[model samples]
Target: MSTNTENTNAATKRVSPTGLDLDKLTDWLAAEHPGMVAGELSATLITGGKSNLTYELTDGTNAWIVRRPPLGTIMATAHDMRREYTMADALRGTDVPVAKMYAYCGDKDVLGADFYIMERIDGVPYRYADELRALGEERTRGLSTELVGTLAKLHSVDPAQVGLGDFGRPEGFLGRQVKRWKQQLDTSKTRELPGVEELHAKLLATVPAKSAAGIVHGDFRLDNVLMGPDDLPAAVIDWEMATLGDPLLDLALMLTYQRRAKIVAGYETTDPANYDVTLAPGYLSTEEIMALYEAESGRKLEGFGFHLGLACFKLAGISEGVRYRHINRQTVGEGFEDSGSTVPLLIELGLESLKEHK
Candidate 1:
């Protein structure tokens, strides 16, 4: 299990991660999952995630991954460990590859926050252009195709068939998404952003009348999926934002991330090591990815501009939150200082997407 993002795996005996207590965790595991622990537990914090804190745990023989919400205050609907665990657990036998869920703990007394444990997959999350380039152009293209194909397969699954019919209120989902991201931006606003307010207004006014309902991976991107040894998506890892909504929004958000990776890599202030895998040679273009998705899912993407605009707006709001955290010194790892700069860029892109798509 490799996370190419800002993660550090430092081995320190008996020293648990910042948010976890070894003694308490050991006790809970013993109570919840009997006979799982072979020896004393040692934990290592994998700190790159902005929303949820991930920790790698080992008990001499067995290794597992634990996820919990970030420290401090969060929105009511944000970082629900039970929701994430349930979604992944439901999608187990489906076309959507997900990690094998072990247990979910909603009792805050266990760890001061809700958390879940799951099998640690040994797949690589390729995050950089150079990393994919190592696999050659053909393999990169195939991986990109596999990524979109997996998304289509996921969208094709009936939520009810997976016992997720009541997972979310899909009605008026698009409108709610726009308002939710706007509220998030307002809550995290640190400085004046020129085009955000206008973009928000335009998205509110241009909400699409028709949308296809399906499970939405709110943050769909290449790095979010783990690639197996054969260069296929072994498991789609991050499920913190998974819910029932307009599936096209997932597509729009994915394309937006592709653009974001390119923009981030082009920045002069960006670290030389940072690169966008989507821009790597032989990677599928935005049109090709969409075409493959439409063909596989048999769903026409009508009024796609609004979805793209909303995706950009959502990304902007998320970036603003990152910037807010970075400014407050609440974020960990590198690249956060550049988050504020991307917000305005995302807003401008959102406005352009609306104009072009319209």
Candidate 2:
């Protein structure tokens, strides 16, 4: 997990990992994308992904990526392959860098769940602070600035112009988000978190008025962006949570992660899902990130504290879900063993953010 992730291209004679069938996948690709299979396919489950199951597929000649839901029970509304594929497909010609979507397979018979194929872009997702620090202060600063700029550019895009006007209902997005996360937490609840109810109540009471409607990369963080050799974001992957919503929510989440990144770096902790590269020596500060986003997008942030609180609440809900899966033996990859410990801290952070902002 974290910066330790790398796609190993070494050819191996092995069976497909859990939740994927290489032979069936080859058949589907040959039918859907004719002549793309080339030879017998091999797939390795890509690590560092905490939510969706990502696999790097190769047919001895070409390499592609397949994204699907994790094996075992998943939330009905979560892990939408079509939604992820649609967002990336729509953003092809936009300033937001996304991988090239080749095809989408919605039939459950093909992969036991909806899935999509996209051309693998050779880019590095720097997940740890040290990995970014290794790039030296100047390069790290530039990459971090580009990361913020890419998000601002994403917020500047008009969803209607990109054929994603109806991607999500922005009219009551904030309210629905609070309620949705509460419901999500309910479904994944395993233990009584002390501050969960208080955080939920605070978020529900402090819903911010919508500012601007645009694409919200629901999970906007350094690890989610793939950096090319030139220190620019080559592609923004993991759009399973992307949708039309208040763009400021994305900013708040990014800020919250940066704060957490600083804490992680300070404590020298190893929470893969929460690591952020912004804590590197020369990365942008939270204040600079907000100012740069406001300047680049021309959208002044209002009621940002509420957005930050909501972001923490949403993250708490998500972490609780991950904790639930880990306890039930349903999670994939490493670093999930510590998920249960973050929920209460996230809830506490949400409450504190609300109080401080208020």
Candidate 3:
């Protein structure tokens, strides 16, 4: 059976699709593009991509990436191709790095699921802490700075420039986030867990007092930032989570200070090869990342405390959702050995964040 993916961001979900039993991918390619004689499709099973099935494809000489919803019952409506396409299209002339889209296939008849193909961007994803450390001090510093800078550029982009104004519900965004995730977690309840409710209440009481809504990389973490030859960020992938909202919350999601404290997943490093991402000693501090926004975007850095708290809350809910999958026997791959302790650690992290921001 195919693996199930955990939901880590609001609105964007990782799910394995159902009845995708088509080896006809080659036939479709051949007929659609005429001269392009597509042969046997090679699916390089890329793991750690909990929600999407990413296949690195090659049509004889040319390479492309195929992405489809994971196999299973997904909660939301049809996949948001409009949103994903928007980010890739918008990044065309911007400083932010994104894959150049080749074509988007919405006809589920072709592949038993809707999928898209984009020119494969080359770079390695890190799976080990040591690998991040091994990038050496110099490369790691550059990697960290560039990663932060890429996010800064993403937030600074003019939504009007890319015709993406119809993306999200901007007003009262922070106010609704707490309740939104709380309801999701509640509905997916497989266990009677405590402190989850309390965490939501604490977060709702302190939504960010101010926000600079922009093109937010909803899941801007080290893993999402693509690293080039010398550990420099090539492009940020996984735009299913991208939205227009408070950019600082996006920053905090990347840090994931809370999720680290509380454990989830079979192992922290799914792939040991390139998972080592070192946060440089002088990389943008929480305060500095926010300050840079103030100077560049003209959005005051007020209620930063609230944003930090919300980030922690979001991570906790995400981890808990993954934990729920494990309990229900719906998760793929392996289960964590230290789950008993992991859940508590996450709750504590959420509570600690609340106190810090308060």
Candidate 4:
């Protein structure tokens, strides 16, 4: 974990030589993964990841990525690396493409916290469908369609059937969202902003019905995926927040990224266009996807209002926590500083979506 609170006055915060330092990192990589013994090894910290510390390591010819918890005190169940590896490894041979996992480490002596190494994906995928428009709108739309279509495939997967029976509760996913995110907000909180508690209370009163529970990628966005040079998605990264939930919530999160409503740190301006990139379209419209999902899974996805509302609430909690980290200067990748106003904006978007629906 890269987050070392050296400036903190706490004793445990003073854990010297936190995690696996690079020298040991090289030795560990050499022993566990094949082909790293003879080649020179280089380790570089990947910043801008808000949650886990990601490292890019190369042993001369071969390269891989290591993901672990941030240094210092961390919530046990939340940042569990074993669980992260479990999800990533589980996706193998499935429709979902993930970077291949090389090994999972639970030994604290190897590094302070648990860590895992996986194959490194090449090239950036289309975080914004517009980023692919370098080809043209029609072609971008085709690629974008594949993305949403792939998402539908993901939502259709049976967590239990796919050998992921240990994933966790799926029966009442939408029901648990608010409580879970609220706890996250409480744990990571470092500052206060207006309307947060009020907004949360309102959400408690306004939660919509659970439509259908399925495998929801807790954090689904374009940037989370990598596209090959062919302009197609090569792999999906960051499975730490994966969960079972109302799949519509995943769609709503995708929408929020489309508009990037939360303000970022360095860029003070709130530009809706930045998020206007419909990274995936033909695959995820409420009508199109619900039709596909219901037909494929034989399940009902009726509670659009509730699902959209939950999405807004989810975004608010995430943005608020991010805003807290931003003020403290703990965030690596910038943007989302104006998360103060994202709640209202998303709620408005939800309301508009509803109006358009009617």
Per-residue lDDT of model 2, residues 1-358, tens digit only: 2322333324543466776777677778777789777787877789877789998888899999999998778888889899999999999999999999998999999778999999899899887777977789999889888988999899888999999988998888999889989998999989988978878887777776555678998999888999998889999999999898888888888888777656556666555444466767898899999898888888876667888899888888788888888899987677777785767767777887776544
Ranking by TM-score: 1, 2, 3, 4
Which of 1 and 2 is the better model by lDDT?
Answer: 1
lDDT of candidate 2?
A: 0.83
Question: What TM-score, over all chains together, does every model reach?
Answer: 0.93, 0.92, 0.80, 0.77
Off by over 4 Å in 1: 1-13, 264-272, 333-335
Q: Judge candidate 4 at residue 356 and give its lDDT.
A: 32
Off by over 4 Å in 3: 1-22, 31-37, 77-82, 208-210, 257-300, 326-343
Q: Which model scores highest in TM-score?
A: 1
RMSD of each: 3.7, 4.0, 6.8, 5.8
Q: Write the per-residue lDDT of candidate 3 for residues 143-233, one digit (tens) a residue.
A: 6667667777888887877777867767777887777667656655656667877877877776666666788766777677678886677
Residue lDDT tens for model 4, 198-291: 5556556656543566777777766677767776778878887777667777776776555443323224453433543453333244455456
lDDT of each: 0.84, 0.83, 0.62, 0.63
Q: Compared to the true structure, candidate 3 yields what TM-score?
A: 0.80
Model 2: lowest-lDDT 10 consecutive positions: 1-10
How well does candidate 3 score on lDDT at residue 99?
84
Worst 10-residue lDDT window for candidate 3 reads 13-22
Clashes of 1: 0
